[model samples]
Target: MTTPTLPENGEHLLARATAILAKGSQIEIRNLVRSLYPAEAAFVLEALEPEPRASLWRLIPPGVMGEVLIELNVEVATALLAITDRKDLMAATEQMGADGMVDLLHVLPEPLLSQVMESIGVHNRNRFEQALSYREHTAGGLMSQDVLTIRADVTLDVVSRYLRLRGRVPAGTDSLIVVDRKDSFQGVLAISQLLTHDPHTKVSELMDTKSPGISYKTPSRDVAALFERRKLLSVPVLADDGKVLGRITIDDILDVIREEADHSLMSMAGLTEEHDMFAPVVASAKRRALWLGVNLLTAFLAAWVIDLFEDTIQQIVVLAVLMPIVASMGGIAGSQTLTLVVRGLALGQISGGNARGLLFKEISVGLLNGLIWAVVVAAVAGVWFHNPHIGILLGAAMLINLVCAAFSGVAIPVLLQKIGVDPALAGGVLLTTVTDVVGFMTFLGLATLFLL
Candidate 1:
C-alpha cells in the first residue's frame, strides 16, 4: 500500500514559527496550527514558542492537543501539560487511545493522577486505571483500551453484527476481542473474520484463541518483540483478572519503539529528548556538559598518554598532528560496531547467549578494517613525516586502537545490561570515551617507543 503523504513544510516552517513566536504573537502561532493538516498542525504546535505553546495550547481544542501531544516529545509534553488545566489535561487524556493514555499516565506524576483520571470517560477509566497498576515497563502499561470484545456464546450473526461496529468505539477501535460472560478473555477475532464467517455461528466457534499474546506484566520492549516475532498487527491486553481490557495495536507498539528510539538517538548525541524550548540555553548546555565533561575526562586520559610522549612529539612535530587521525578513525570504526550491537540488543536479535557471537563478529570486523585502514594511514605518515619508524608506529597503534575499540564498544553495552543499566541511556558516551582514550594512548605510546 502507498504511504500517506506527510506535509512538506520542510525547511522554512521552523523559520516561520520562530518569527511568529519571537513576536510573542499568540494569534499567528495559533493560526499556524489551525491552518495545517492534522499532522502539519501537530508539527506547527511543536515548533511554536514555549511561552506561546503553553498559552496557545489551551486555545486549541483538547482533541487537537491530544493528537499533537503524541507527536511532541515527552519533555515538551510534560512542560505543556504542566501549564494546562486539569480539565484540559483530562480532555487530552480521554481523547487519547489506550496505549497513548498508557504513555501519558506513565509520565504524568501522582498528584495530577486523580485529575487526569477524573477526565477519562467512566467506562474507560476503570480499564486505563487498571493498566496503571501494572509495573511501568510491563505490557499492561503499554496496551491500548481500543479493543472489540464480544460474548463467546453470542451467535455468529450477532457477533458479525457487533463486529460491524468497528469504527464506533469511543477511543477509536479496529480489532475484535472475545470474552466469556464473566469478562475473562476467550479469544481474539479479527474484524475481517466477522464478515467472512457464517452469520449463524457462535463467537466461540469463530475466534482464534490459540494465537500467542503476551500478558500485561511483560516489559514493553518484550511486547514489541512479540509483534515482530509473530508478525501481528494487534495484540490483546488482559487484566490481572484475565478479562480483555484492550488491544495494543501495532501503531501503539511502534510508538513505544519510536519513543525508545528517540531516547537512544538524542541521548547518543548528548542531547536530552526534552520538549521545553523555553529552558535556558545553560540548562540544555548543562545536560550536554555533564556528558561532555565525561568525554573530556576520557580525552584528558588520552592526553596524558601524549604527555608521556612529549619528547617524541617535540622531535617529530608531524606525529602530533597525525595522531588524531588514527584515534578518530578508531572512534568512527568503533561507533559503527557500537550502533550495530546496540540496535541488535535493543531489538532482541542479540540476547545474552548470542552476544558472545556478536562480540566475535564485531571484533573481527574491527580488526580487518583496522588492518586495511592502518595500511593507508601508515603509508601516508611515512611519506608525510619522512620517517619509516613513525610509519611503523602508526601501523602498530592503528591496529591496537581498532582492536581495543571493537572490544570496548561491544562490551560496554553488554556490561551495562549485566549491571541493570539502561544501556541505551549512556552507552554512546561511554563507548565513545573508551575508543577515544584507547586510540590516543595507543597512538602516542607507540610513537614514543618507535620514533624516539
Candidate 2:
C-alpha cells in the first residue's frame, strides 16, 4: 500500500477522518486510518461517536489492531472486543506482550476469555496465567515478562557477545537485570556501564545492588511513586522469596500515573476514567442516576435541617437572603481542604502521625479565613439589611461553619480511608453535606434562639 499524506496536527487528522467518515467513503477512511500509527488511530476511534467509532474501528488494519486496542480506553476496547470475531481477536492478541494481554483479558467476559486463553501457545498461556494471578492494580500485573537478564559472574565481554547474539533487547532496556543461578533477584547493570566499562569487568563489579526490587504484590500507585522517586527506566518485580517475577518499565508506570490522575479527577465528580464520553443516552443516564440519587439524598438532608428552623426563616426574612452566603462560603472552604487532604492521602504524604498536625493547621487556616470573610460578610449584611444584630448572627454562623467545614474536611477522608472507602470518591460528597448542614444549622439555629 502507498503511504498516504498525513495531517500535521492530531486534531486536523481527527477532523479530516471524521469528515471522511461522515461521507461514508469506506476505502478513503480505511486508507486515512491505516496510515496513522496505532495510537493515533485509537485516538480517532475514541473521538468518534459510537456508530462512527464502530465504522472507523472496522477500517483499522488487522496487523495493528492489538496495539490500537491497547491504546483505547477500557470501555471502548471492551465494546470493540464484543463485536470482533473470535478468530480476529485471537490473531490480534497472538503477539501482544504479557502485560497487554492481561489487560485485555480483564475486560473480556469469562467464557470468551477462556476461549482466548485456550488458543494461546503453552508458553504464552503460562505467562498470561502467571500475570493474571496478581491483582490488576498490583506491580505484577503492570510488569512485562520480556526482560533481559544477565548472570552476576559474567564479564562485560560476555555480556556484549550475548547481546550481539540476541540481536535486540526489550523496548525500555536501559539496564540488564542481574540474577543469581536460581533466577532470584540480584540487581541491575546499566546499559551505559556495559558500553563504557572495561570488557574484563565482571557484571557484579558494575551492577547496582542498592536499587531495590518492588514486590509483585505492591500496589500500582506505590509502584508509580517508586518509579517517579527513583527516576527509574525499569524495575524488577519479585516474589517474597526474591524470585524475579517480571519487570515494570517506565512506559507501564506512565500508564499507571495517567490512570490514577484520571481516576482522581473523575472520582471527584462521581465518574470513572473508563466512562465513555459518547456512551448511549440511557446507559449514561443510568450510570449518572446513581450519583444524582446520592446527591439528592444529601440535598434532602440539608433541606430537612432547614425545615427544622422554618419558623426562624419566616420570622427573619433577611436570614433567608444571607443563608446561602454562609453555606456557599463554607462549602468552598471545605472543598479546598478536602481536595488537599485527598491528594495528600493518595501520594502517601498524609499519615496517622502527621494527620493531627495537618488537622490543626487546616483548622487554624479556617479560623483565620473565617475571621476575614466573616467580618466582610457581617459588615455588608449589616449595611444592606440595616440590622447589626442580624449581621452579628450571620458572622458568628459563618465563623462556626467555616471551622466545622475545616474539621470535616480533614476528618472525613481519614475516617473513610480507615474504613476502606476511597477518599477521593466519597470525601467530596460527605464534606459538602457536613458544610451545608453545619452552615444551615448554625445560621438558622442562632436566628431561632435570638431573633425569635
Best by lDDT: 2
Strongest candidate by TM-score: 2
**Per-candidate local distance difference test:** 0.73, 0.88
Cα lDDT tens digits, model 2, 307-392, are 99888888887788888999999999999999999999998899989999999999999999999988998898999999988999
What CA root-mean-square deviation does each model show from the true structure? 4.0, 2.6
**What are the runs in model 1 whose C-alpha is more than 4 Å off?**
1-6, 9-32, 36-39, 52-55, 66-71, 82-128, 151-153, 162-174, 239-242
lDDT score for candidate 1 against the true structure? 0.73
How would you encode candidate 1's per-residue C-alpha lDDT over 1-452 as one tens digit per residue? Answer: 99997655645776776676678766786786576554555566566666666665667777666666666666776777777777777667766666667666766767897777776678778877777777766776666655667887877777655645654653434456777879888777666766787778777776788866567877888888888888888777776788776677777778678767777877676675653555668777777778778878877787776787788779878877877887787888778877887787788787768888888988898889889887887788788778877887788888888988888878988888779876777787777677767777787777676556
Model 1: number of backbone collisions: 5
